[model samples]
Target: MAKLLEIRWHGRAGQGAKTAALVLAEAAISAGRYAQAFPEYGPERMGAPMQAFNRISDEPITVHSHVTNPSIVVILDPTLIAATNVKAGVPADGIYLVNTTMGPCEMRKRLGLTDSPAKVYTLDATQISMDTIGRAMPNTPMMGALVGATGLLELDQLIADTREKLGRKLRPEIVEKNIEAIRRAFQEVAS
Candidate 1:
């Protein structure tokens, strides 16, 4: 059977969770994999909580639905950790990639999952974004962390795809900064 990887992203309306999911799907496709990316929005306002889902597999995917049991969960906004049940459908062996200044051990303690089987990883994605992209938007950085945590796609492929897709709409400098954010996050994520 082909292995299917399900990912769920949680963030606010303006944080680019949807964009990150789309980019990952695109990168996966570029790497000759089958993938799907979609988003669920609530209230349709900036800062409003939302979700994005991705399914990547070696073979074609037939199911098109929300990921209730995600093998990987990416949290772009740390505040949402408390506001939402971030672990609702995550399995014991699931991996969590969170954007915060806290390290993985601290994150485990705060989430009350120190003894759980789930693996917690964290990076200061917000800081990385601010330093590289000049903004606090952590979506791109979190994407890097996702790749690092899961190894579902090649890091170089993700950077190339991101530049190609985002360059069409953004300035060259912004694109470079975003790529840098991704690279930094990929290397900095701690378990």
Candidate 2:
């Protein structure tokens, strides 16, 4: 939390990338930190590719624009690796948290990032979400991975905030299941 932590989220429409970014921003604000979250859309349809950005820091964020260079990048759809330059603008020390069934090592090789300085982490978030929430949504689980990989916020705080934010619009059971997904994803993400 010493410097601004910028995060870029890559996901398709209906995958909850925007929702996850908003939730993470809200969680950061709830923890008394300054944050910003917003989404960039393309075709504006389900299954269309999109991007979301988040900036969390101890100080106020003065910039209001897309995050071209992110400290962390969360890829909700592994397919984007082949479809887009998911690693664009990322520095050597950046971290990539990808939602994929493949292990990190395999993912690195698949993405041809074995020589890259950026650290790569992978988690079967879709499986975790399907198992816990009965859906294939990877956004919530990816948030857990984001926290786990970055440590920008505490795990408990994230769960509490997620429950509170989603509790209003969703069923109690769904909320609980999402929390479980988050917890499992946090623990299960592999480097």
Candidate 3:
């Protein structure tokens, strides 16, 4: 049986939280896994906080339940940590990919975080996105951190899948920039 991976995304509407989930699911499927992606909508307005989820496994996923015990929790917005219980329902050893420049120690101080068992990979995806894509939307760069933090998929494959998934939504130049961002993030993980 293939290992299962559940991911929960916390971000505002229009920030590509849903897109991120879909892209990840698609990538997994392309890699010969069963995957599903969906989002929970609320208030239904841009900038309103929302959640998206993904499930991937070798065996066919039969469960239709919302993810309450995600293996990976991605925080696309740093503010969501304060605004919502972003850590809710995560396993003690769950991995967190947070978009921030703050080091783990500094992040703990800035967020006033009490010690938690979950491991975290923090990156300035906001800055990386702005520099790479010329926008503050961090979905693509956040994918880089995800790849870096966890060797869930091949970095090149992920970037290729992402480009294919986002091709029409972004210009060719932007796509190239995003590829560069992912490369940088992959190197960041190695160094």
Per-candidate TM equals: 0.97, 0.97, 0.91
lDDT for each residue of candidate 2 in 97-116, tens digit (9 for 90 to 100): 99998999999888778888
- Note the residue pairs that clash in candidate 1: none
Give the per-residue lDDT digits (tens) of candidate 1, residues 1-191.
13998989999999999999999999999999999999996669998999999999999999977799998889998899899999988889888988888989999898878889989999999999999999898998998888887787899999999999889889999999999999998999899
List pairs with backbone clashes in candidate 2. none
Clashes of each: 0, 0, 0
Give the Cα lDDT of each candidate. 0.91, 0.92, 0.82
Between prediction 2 and prediction 3, the one with superior lDDT is 2
lDDT of 2 at 116: 83
**Stretch of 10 with least lDDT, candidate 3:** 182-191
Between candidates 1 and 2, the lDDT winner: 2
Per residue, candidate 3 scores C-alpha lDDT tens digits across 1-191 of 33778999999998889998998888888888899999997778988999999998988999999999998888899888888988788887787788877776666555545486667778887887788778888887787778788878788778879899889787888889988877776655321
Residue 13 alpha-carbon offset, candidate 3, angstroms? 1.1
RMSD of 3: 2.1
